[model samples]
Target: MKRDSCQQRIYAVRRVGLAIDRAARATSKIDKRQAARWATAWGVACGVRQF
Candidate 1:
């Protein structure tokens, strides 16, 4: 029973870790997309076509 509990704890920790990794990846993707949009807007404002 103790071993099973320990295994459960490990599984929970792994799930939490995976969730954090997924969140970080999602946030990074959003940040990258926002940066791209901002760059495009700035380029347009400056009349530059070489992005």
Candidate 2:
């Protein structure tokens, strides 16, 4: 609930989201699968219960 904490969370999500996006754009199928896994981790880090 603190101001700095909220900003830090936003920054963390942005970093993870960017990595997942880059992975998603890879031409190899393996990369895409890896990206899917990263997405789950990212979701968990962002406090998403279900997606």
Q: Pick the candidate with the highest lDDT.
A: 2
Which lDDT tens digits does candidate 1 get at residues 2-46?
A: 557556656555554554455556557776565555545544434
Q: 38, model 2: CA deviation in Å?
A: 1.1
Candidate 1 C-alpha RMSD relative to the actual structure = 18.3
What does the lDDT come to for candidate 2? 0.72
List where candidate 1 sits over 4 angstroms from the true fold.
1-3, 27-51
Top candidate (TM-score)? 2
Worst 10 residues of 2 by lDDT: 42-51
In Å, residue 36's CA in model 2 sits off its true spot by: 1.5
lDDT of 2 by residue, 20-47 (tens): 7878688998888887777677666666
